[model samples]
Target: MSAAQLVLDLALTVRHDGRGGVADDLEDAEGLTAWVAAHTAELAEAAALPDPLAPFTADPAALTAVRDLRRAVRTLFARAVRPAPPSPADAERLLPADEALDRLAAAAARVPVAPRLTWPEPGPAELTYRPAAPAPPVDLLVSGLARAAAAFLASDDRDRLRACHAPRCVRYFLKEHPRQEWCKPSCGNRARVARHQRRHRADAL
Candidate 1:
């Protein structure tokens, strides 16, 4: 894939602003670990590159390094996904990988791109817009991660982010208003109905 497409896919996989909060599905540490494994494989395949260690013959060492970097990213993802006591294995798995991703991100920032117009010019304006260079891969990845983290960290009551409280719905959302609940109202209604039915059954007894 082209560099742009790889960047876009990485953003989608890491941030996951889909109709449903697929990111939240991998809520716990183990889930996060599993998610990284699954997504890394998909990404590598989508890029049409051979295993991270193959297809880049100019520098076999660099290919191995990139593969290790990817592994590190997976480790960070697992840590971010879970909230649990850290074990020795988890610590060992995480630190080097996290450092590698950070370094890789820094290096990726050096790749340049041509600037494009942000908006169409009005008539006779001479198209006087100068585009800025594109951000490095590290910046894109980090920025996307920040957005996703904010969505998860912000509270629903604060009018920032939200998670569907329905038993059957596992989605996260950005609430448009203070009272907003689920990504869709139907999910909220279903949850309410389920709650009501449970209460009524208990009352009948």
Candidate 2:
């Protein structure tokens, strides 16, 4: 797994939670921690790649960097649903998600590549050399994740993405089925019960 793959995996996980409703807070820190832990093996596999440039070692520092980057990504997604007015501290605390994607794109562009070359040879013989394109970098992965988020946020097609209406389950999910709601049926049931209770109380009054 490359850094790019790790980021993409995180993107999918983040999108999974966005199904019910946009999470407005890190209300379930335990859940978040568990999610991160579950992905650790995948992250380790991705971290095995060689360093991006010379003088950079892919060691503990790289692992730490990836973890920090993922954490930042989580925070950005959390903030998107419940944005607070930008304070100086807020700006300093987290990388703006769009900016992070842009940075990733820029980094991806900087990856070295060998251009294809062709040479004419005598008597209709020709020689050519072409370099294989490098695999996508982490930045491109980040950009893709950002695009997915944007699509979910901006699209009017309710069928593509939806927020879980279940109480306290503010997660987003893709609507794979026409009747799907609340990411899981459990949440749906909870929502129905809550609704029923509210209506019952109202009728009593």
Candidate 3:
């Protein structure tokens, strides 16, 4: 997946609970740990991690840090799609744009990495980044997420970023087509049903 996808995935961790409420996928340490493991490849690619498939376990502190980053990411996501309303998850309590940008930048700087040049006999030379200092995997994960989010926000792909306002969904999705509305088919179904209901109620009155 592209780096922008990784950022969208992080923001989407907060989603509808199926019972008509919002839910956090990383609500606890176990959840965070599992989420990290499931998306290791994306994290590694986005963060340029040393080991592409190394296992990662998140602790309570890591969970807290990730949630904080999530807040900043979501807040910026809200701003990226202007004129349109933001996701309902925390629209009223979103951090200021400046604060969110500062937090994201701070998290990304937590682990410094420098590019190293390398070449294989049959391949062109490429630069692979190496961390300048020893840091915990959790720290790398958070910084990687922040960096990916920042990159996405600054990219042209940000134009496709959208907030799915369908019913109970509180997700930020990348619009795949000009005609696309909701994040998924399920959300479209919900929105259509809601529109039908409103018309029916109007007819009843």
Candidate 2 per-residue lDDT over residues 1-205, each given as its tens digit: 4344444345344332444433321224444344445545543343322233212223343333344444454444445434323212223456777765554444334333344445566445443222134443343222333333333333443234444556656344445777776667887898899999999999999
Clashes of each: 0, 14, 0
Across 73-168, the per-residue lDDT of candidate 3 in tens digits comes to 889998999889999997786999999999999999998988889999999999867677778887788888888888889999999999998998
Ranking by lDDT: 3, 2, 1
Candidate 1 Cα outliers beyond 4 Å, as residue runs: 1-159
Error of 3 at 126 (Å): 3.2
In candidate 1, what are the lDDT values of residues 123-151, reduced to their tens digit? 34322211134443333323333222222
**lDDT value, candidate 3, whole model:** 0.87
Candidate 3 regions off by >4 Å? none
User: Sorted by TM-score, highest first, which candidate order results?
Assistant: 3, 2, 1
List runs of model 2 lying over 4 Å from the truth. Answer: 1-159
Task: Supply candidate 3's per-residue lDDT for 33.
Answer: 86
lDDT of each structure? Answer: 0.40, 0.43, 0.87
